[model samples]
Target: MKRLAVSLTLFLVLSLGVGLLVSGSEVLDWGIAGGLFAIAVLGECFRFWIRRTRSKKRDSSSV
Candidate 1:
């Protein structure tokens, strides 16, 4: 499941990269915006993950 999530993330990033390369005339501009949004979402996900991991660790240590 973790591997699938990682792979899908990579796939989306690569697809956006290819889209930037293959399109012409304002094609890349939109892709850039999309890329930024993707990055922001990923950042939030990572923050949540870190918080969850830390809480889990603390819970286990306290027991």
Candidate 2:
């Protein structure tokens, strides 16, 4: 079940990627792609911040 879910998600992403490439000229000048790239970077930064905060709290509580 989990594998099927993962595979479907991968398939969808790949399809979207190929579609984008095929229609590149239509959206090549649009900055939406850049915004998505920024969002991905920010998402990683937020994940790191939350993990660090949780670890710090756990360490302090152990004392």
Candidate 3:
């Protein structure tokens, strides 16, 4: 969880920095930053879920 939080924070900061550097419009910058943040969060969640499910399958098969 701590690692996830750190990764998410890093993603947000990088996205915001990139957005600001790439776009002149305030709204577009924020939109780009928000979109990237959402993608990072969803990707992390999906990876966690996949790992959890795989572990569960392995544990059950070993029983």
Candidate 4:
């Protein structure tokens, strides 16, 4: 989880930096940044859901 968060953050920063350098447009940069942010949030939500389901399975099996 920690690693995932770190990697996602790094990717966002790197992407934004590259986008800014290539486009030099704040409006486009914000658009790209918003898309990336949405993707990151979705990824985290998916990860959390997977972990929750796995833990529930483990708990049921143990009982």
- Top candidate, metric lDDT: 3
Determine which window of 10 residues in candidate 4 has minimal summed lDDT: 19-28
Error of 2 at 63 (Å): 5.0
**What ordering of candidates by lDDT runs from best to worst?**
3, 4, 1, 2
Instruction: Please identify model 2 stretches exceeding 4 Å from their true place.
Output: 1-27
* Per-residue C-alpha lDDT of model 4 across residues 1-36, encoded as one tens digit per residue: 788779788878866875676566453566776677
Summed backbone clashes in each candidate are: 0, 0, 0, 0
Screening candidate 4 with a backbone cut-off below 3 angstroms (N, C-alpha, C), the clashing residue pairs are: none
| Better-scoring candidate (lDDT), 3 or 4 | 3
In candidate 2 the C-alpha lDDT for residue 36 amounts to 51
Single out the weakest 10-residue window by summed lDDT for candidate 1.
24-33
Which regions of candidate 1 fall more than 4 Å away from where they truly are? 1-28
Model 4 TM-score, 2 decimals: 0.65
Better of 1 and 2 by TM-score: 2
Report the lDDT tens digits of candidate 2 across residue range 1-63: 565456555655554565577566684423554455455556656766998899999889853
RMSD of each: 5.4, 6.7, 1.9, 2.8
Question: How much is the lDDT of residue 41 in candidate 1?
Answer: 65
Off by over 4 Å in 4: 21-28
Note the Cα lDDT for every prediction shown. 0.69, 0.60, 0.89, 0.76
